[model samples]
Target: MPAAPEMPWLPAQLNALLAQQGHALLLEGPSGLGQFALAMGWAKALLCEAHALGTPLAPACGVCESCHAVQVHTHPDLLVLLPEAMQLDLGWSSADTDSASEAKRKPSQEIRVEAMRKMITFCQRTDARGRGKVVVVYPAESMNTVTANALLKTLEEPPGNSRFVLATEASHRLLPTIRSRCHSWKMAWPADAEIHAWLSAGHSTAEQVQGAMQASGGRPQNAWELLQSGFEPQAWSQLPRQLLQGQAGLLAAASPSQTIAVLQQLCHDVMAMVVGAVPRYFSQDSLKPLVAHLGAQTGETITQQLQQGGQSPRQRTLERLAQWSVDLQQAQRTSEHPFAPELMLTALLDQASQALQAKR
Candidate 1:
C-alpha cells in the first residue's frame, strides 16, 4: 500500500501516545480536530507487525501487510464501531444483518446495542494476528446508555491482549464510568500557518486556502472538506448581507441541518461583533457593512448598557439576535426531520432576515 497523506499535527501526537502505556485510551477534543484520524493511527501503529518487532515508538510501516489491511479496512485483528449513518458517510460497510429490514429503515445516527454486543464478542475472541486485537469506537458519545453499558464491563476488564480506543468530539456526553475506565488524551489544535501550508499543498488555491482556514476557524480537516465542497469563500463573506436582503437561494441546495449550521456560525459572529469582538467564521469586512446599521455606539457602550440592563436600540438588536440564536438551536434539534426543502429554506430565510433587520 502507498503511504497515507500526513495530517501535519497527528504524527507527533501519535508517537507521544505510542510511548504511553494503557489498555484503553479516550481521545477527546472538539469537532474537526481529527480525533478519528488520531485514533485510527494509534490502532494501526499498535497492530503493525514491524512496530511490534522493532521500536515500540515507531509509526506503522505502510508496506506491511497489517498496514495494508488497515488501509483497506479488512484487518482481521481490528474492529471499528461507528453508527450506521457515519459508516455510510465514511464509506465503510455495516455488518450484514437482515438486509430486507435494514433496507426499510433509515441508517441510525447512534451506535446501537447490537453493535456493542458484537464488539464485546470480538473482544473475547483470540487475536488473528499475534500483534493483538484493537477495537476503535469513533464519536464515542454516539453510544447511548444501553450501548455504553454493554461495553462498560469489557472496558473495565478486557480479555487477553485486547486494547480499546474511544474517540469523541463531546466528552461530556459520555458516561462517567466509560470516561473513568480509560486514559484520556486531548487532541491538539494545529496553528494557522501549519493549516495554511497543508491546505495549499493540496488542490486549494492561496485565496481558497485563506477562506477555508477562516471559514473552518483554522481546523485543517474542516478547511479541506470546505474546499472540497465547492463553497466559495466569496459567497461566505457575502452571506450576511445576502441574508439581510432576503436571499434564500444561496442555501437552496443545502439540507436543513447544513443551512442551520451555517446560520448558527453567522449568528455567533454577529453576536461577537455586536459586543465588539472578532468574528470567527467570517471576515470582519463582510460583516462590518451589515452590522453598521446598528448605529454609532461602540462595543463598550453596548456592553455597559447590557450590564445595566438598559433598553438601547443596540440592546434591543442584541436581544433579538439572542432569541434568533435560541430559535436556530431549536431548529437544529429537529433539522433532520423530513420537510419540504424549499418551504424550510424560505421560512429559515425569513426568520434570519427579520432578525438581521431588527433595530428597535
Candidate 2:
C-alpha cells in the first residue's frame, strides 16, 4: 500500500495502534480524539488486498483497488454502523434506504437493533471480495440497550476473517458484558503542536486558527469545524464581554446544546479565576469580571487590587461564579430539550449577570 505518512487519514497515534493485535478492537476516548479516523484507518489496513506490501502496522497500499474502495466507503466487505441520523447525514444510506417510497420520519439518534442484526448476517458470510470483512461502529455508545444486546452474541464469538472496530466517546455507556468481548484501546490526544500544524494546513489565518482552537477547547476536529463554519477571531475573542453585555448575536445562532456548552466553558473559566487556578478557555484579561467586585456595572472597569489576606471583593466574586458553574452543569443536561431559543439565551445571560453581580 502507499505510505501511511502520505495518507491524511492516519493520525500519528493511530499509526502506532495499527501495529497492535486484536480481532475485536474497541477504540474508546472522548470526542475529537480521532477515534473514527483511527477506526476507519485500521479497517482500511485490515481489508487491504496487497499481500507483498501489507504489514501489521502499515496495511494499506493506497494504490490498490481495495484502498481506493475503502477511501470512497464502497468496499463491499466493509459495513459501517452509525446512528440513523448520522448515517443519513453522512450519505451512508443506499438509494433504497433514501427512496421517497419509504416512510418518512425523523432519523433516529440511536443505533437500531435491526442494523446490528444485519451486521451479524454480513459477518457470517464468506469474504465478499477476497479481503476479510470489516465492521465499523462509530460512536458505539449510540447503541441502545436492545441494539447492544443483539450485538453481544456476535461480539462474544468470532466468524472467520471478520473483525470489529467499535469507536466510542462514552465507553461507560456500553454494556459491561459487551466491553469484555473486545480488546479496548484508548485514543490519545494529539499534542498542541500537531493540532496547530493540522489547523494551519488549510487556508486559515493564524489568528483565526488560534481563536478556533481555543473555542474548541483544544479539539482539533472541532477547531477545523469551527473554521469551516466561518468563525471570526475578533468575535471569539470578544465573546466573554459580549455575553456579559447581554448581546447574543453569534451565540444565539448556535444550537441549544452548543450554546449551553459555550456558556459552560465561560462559567468554568470564571470559576477558575475565582479560585486562582489559571483558566482553560478564557485568558485572564477576558475573565476580569471574575476578579471584579459584586454589583459592578457593565463597562465600568474595576481596578481594585485583590486583598492578599482578607475577605476581599475578588473572594466574594469567586463564590458567586462558583455557584454559577454548578447551575450551568444542570443547565447543560437540559440543553437537549431547550426552552424557546430567545428565552433560553435571555435566561442564560440573566443567570450569568446575576452571578457576576451577587454579594457575599
Best by the TM-score measure: 1
lDDT of 2 by residue, 1-360 (tens): 111122243556566777677789898987776777788878888777776434445757688898898878788899999987777545576544565644375566778877888898898889877768889997899999888987887887778788899999999999999899998998777778877877777678998889888878887777887888888877766777766665664786787667778878887877776676887776677667544633353233244332333445656566767788888888887776666767877777788778766321
Q: What's model 1's TM-score?
A: 0.90
All candidates: CA RMSD (Å): 3.8, 5.7
Error of 1 at 15 (Å): 0.4
lDDT (C-alpha) at residue 126 in model 2: 93
lDDT of 1 at 225: 79
Candidate 2 backbone collisions, by pair: 1-60, 1-61, 2-61, 2-62
Model 1, 204-281: lDDT tens digits are 689999998888877777878788788588888877777766676458678888899889898899889988999999
Best by lDDT: 1
Off by over 4 Å in 2: 1-11, 52-57, 88-96, 99-104, 290-339, 358-360
